[model samples]
Target: MINRRIMMTSLAAGLIAPAFRSAFAQEWKAKYPELIFAIIPEENASGTVERYTPFCAYLSREIGTKVTLRVVQDYAALIEGQKSEQIHVGWYGPASYARAYLTGAKITPFVIEVSSGGIKGYYSVFYVKKDSPYQSVADLKGKNLGLVDPNSTSGNNVPRFVLDKMGIDPDKYFNKVVYTGSHENAVLAVQQGTVDVAANWWNSDDDSNLTRMAKKGMVNKDDFRIIYKSDIIVNSPIAYLDSLPEDLKAKIKQAFLEAATKDKDAYAKLSDGKDDPFQPVDHSAYEPVVNLVKFIDGLRKKNG
Candidate 1:
């Protein structure tokens, strides 16, 4: 005689097996019905919207899942989403990625929007007013310098790292330092003479932020000069949560790399008309960023 409890338990298991099997065999679509990608609105607002719309559409078609793009107000929002595992994919700057990786977010399928000559990196330039006596990094000694933000790679990390290599400690070298919160703010601070120097990232092309400011009459091209430049650091990276299923991770990576080459319009939109193409990359490629963070930590200790 079968016990009543045993009979009920067996019946439930029998009913659930088919459902489990059906889900398992339903391909990646049924696994994650909704795929969400996050981007920083401040850093890449227009470009992000333009690129991700069609890209998500294509990805939805290929993976048979509902892909949605979400934009956050700032880098912190995107980083938080990645930490909570709420975001499946993200486009992160190098310093932001380093901070996330330190907190356990996984880096995968590193890709960069290229410019001329298939470049993966950009440089940090220190700009000062033309009439200012500051002509080079050395001139900033004992003068105020404006940094965009502590977590900013091109604005803060790169500038700090370059100064360290030159045997000049930013904290000790500058008479005062201010955090402007954004690269645009930093540029404005320098242009207004509120700060002695400002640091930012830009390609060799003349049509960058610097040029825009020059064009808008906010600042003249001849009015400001580059006082210092840092070594090229890799552009921001796209990262995923480590807990994602390995197969799903592989498919996402494959999709991005292939899209850059296979979809010309998708690639162009992502690159902002720059000659950038998505190329395969790995976590280890960001070693330089890690090293720069370590150098920054040392500076913090010294300053403290």
Candidate 2:
């Protein structure tokens, strides 16, 4: 009877141990479902949600995990989320990427938007009404100008840097400067004559901005003229948490690159058909933006 009892006890231990191990493994695999992504709000709150929710669903499917997308009020809040690790991934403009990266966020990939010359960067274009007296960047001196956002690359950073290089001080050069919070809002402000000039991101000879305004019947093609264009600025990047697991990071990178090529519809929806999905990237590619930030910071300090 003792020998029979010992054999049964050993068999029971073997059966229960494997079940406990399997449960622990499952719990580990399920952790990614808790990750949340952060995006900046550029348009109306509802419009931003409608545009990005599909992207979250697509990424969730590709990564084989649940993903949630949340739009914080501003770029600063998004950066804060990264610091707190509440946000696992973020799509950030060049300036914001530099800020977050310097603050310890790891930039992993960059979106290559499709344009007239294939995959390329974009420029900041300052525009005025077609009949406006402003003919050049200098003409805007001491005139009211509209800037999209202080943290925006094409909207404010590039434009301000351009002015500083030209020996022009934005605060003193403009009669008044306004932040409209979005590129579209800046464009509308120019069209409506609410401001003499507005800064925005535009592709060279590309119809993206024009088409969008036309779709909404907000402005006509002939109503505006570009006064100045800055050098190309790199497109926004996809950044991940620096402390995420290496194997998981590799999986995420592979998933993004594959989805960009293998899934046309998904790529189009995410990038608004303006670009492909994403390509692998690292910190070195963003050196220019970092320098730009430093230059801007220096100027602000001097003026202050």
Candidate 3:
């Protein structure tokens, strides 16, 4: 009965494997009873908390550990928290994630957003009030420029890269270059005449920071116009520390991948239903963005 014995062994292995995995998961769960998830301050702290708490709840349920949201003041704080390993998981813009990775954070990107259009990339745009005389970057020469945080992707890094490519050094080209601190603030600066033009993220005419702000009645979409749009940059990614166990990372990733279908309400709150779903991604997908951030760093160093 050699065949019968082999079948019995196979079935036993199959049964033991799942139990073994369950036990292993329990061990890690005990080790990490709670996880800290940090998000960059794309909006005000309250808004950030409101948007992510439900998602964090879903993650906690899926991972069998407490997932707490850590809202920081700015992108640098989030980067620093992750670098020190105080933050286990983080949602980051492309440049901020690259900055964290390049500056000694042992993090691995695991999921990226797929837009409702099914695109995995977004553009950095220059915005000006609709009635402003600035029709183009050339029209805004010697005017003020508003940027978001220094670590922002579309708000700072991509805009810097695009301006450099056009032989426009912001310091020399603008009368003043101001960091407005957030995309919403940057847009407000433009609208209120604090800055002549502001750099911010735009996915499409219908889906962007401007559109979201419009929905909140914070800014009228018709009050501004886009002056410049950069080449499509890789979408933002959510990453976790590499020190986390392999099985845990897998579970974290699977939870995100399943979030759209399994936790539709939370997912909708995240992007205002503008994005399709979270898709699997890896470090390789962001290598180009890393290089872009490095290039921007080089410019800063040279200019300094």
Candidate 4:
């Protein structure tokens, strides 16, 4: 009789567990009502929105809350949005994420993109037109240079870091230095002769800003060449505000981890169909990048 009583209690608890979870989820949804996920534009604004919208919808469904997407105009805006907490979550490049953390944003990184090869990083590269005379960094002296954005990791920080290591001050080395605003624009600057060389991100010959543009028929990939490449940079991460309730953070992290299998279409759209599922990450993974941003900031202060 005691054994029967215990079994019935266990059965009752099993039935109640899911209802408890459902109520708990609704509790946070009522508090948040809507969550904002901000992104830095690696592509054009429209393209960035289209690519990320489905992923936002997926998160909304998984977390039982409304998740909306915001494509900030530039990396700095994305950083500021998070710093101000107007943005609840952000997809940040390594340097941009570091910049936010260093500037006093209360945020924690949760997931990083994994390449289809299962690698967790990518490279910054310099692209020049195929028919151009510039053959190397030295050959490009006095030529115009295009960088993506001030807060860009592959587009600005890593390139500046590498150039400094080589004793090249871009301001003194190039006749004119311009921010092209986005990686796609940086590549377009090269093709359009607005800039002789442009710094952009590259994952492989098969996966990169150039290749994506090529696939879209925006540019013939064969018409350009990579004149320089930086060492691997830790892949970009998806980060959320540390101020969020603990359970919400857990839900957001879980939603991202399971999105690849649970929402393959959204994952593929965000990844350009070139990456694996999101993998867990944290503050430690980005310390090197934080130091790198600090070093770059130091250079700017010294130069001024």
TM-score of each: 0.78, 0.85, 0.94, 0.93
- lDDT (0-100) at residue 7 of candidate 4? 100
User: What are the runs in model 2 whose C-alpha is more than 4 Å off?
Assistant: 1-28, 106-117
Q: Rank by TM-score, highest first.
A: 3, 4, 2, 1
Superior by lDDT: candidate 1 or candidate 3: 3
Q: Candidate 1 — what's its lDDT?
A: 0.75
lDDT of 4 by residue, 188-300 (tens): 99889999999999999999999999987899999999889888999999899988988899999999999999989999997689999989999999999999999999999
Q: Compare the candidates by TM-score and give the number of the best one.
A: 3
1-304: candidate 2 lDDT, tens digit per residue: 9999999999999999999766754564577665688888666677678777776677777766777888887777788888888888777878888877666754454333344345557888998999988899878778889998767888888998999889899888899999988877888898877889998887755454654565558678678889998987887777788777665666566766777566667566554676655666776778899889878888889999
lDDT of 1 at 82: 81
Q: What is the C-alpha local distance difference test score of candidate 4?
A: 0.92
Put down candidate 1 lDDT per residue, 1-304, tens digits, no spaces. Answer: 5698899999999999998765754665666898888876433356448656888887676655787999876667777888788898888778878877776665463565555678787888998988888778877789999997777888888888888889988878989889886766788889887899988878775745576556546566777788777878887778877777666777777777777666767666554556556677777877779888877887888778
| lDDT (Cα, 0-100) at 224 in candidate 3 | 93
266 in model 3: Cα distance from truth in Å? 1.1
lDDT of 4 at 216: 79
Better candidate by lDDT, 1 or 4 = 4
The digit string of per-residue lDDT tens for model 3 on 161-181 reads 999989999999999999998
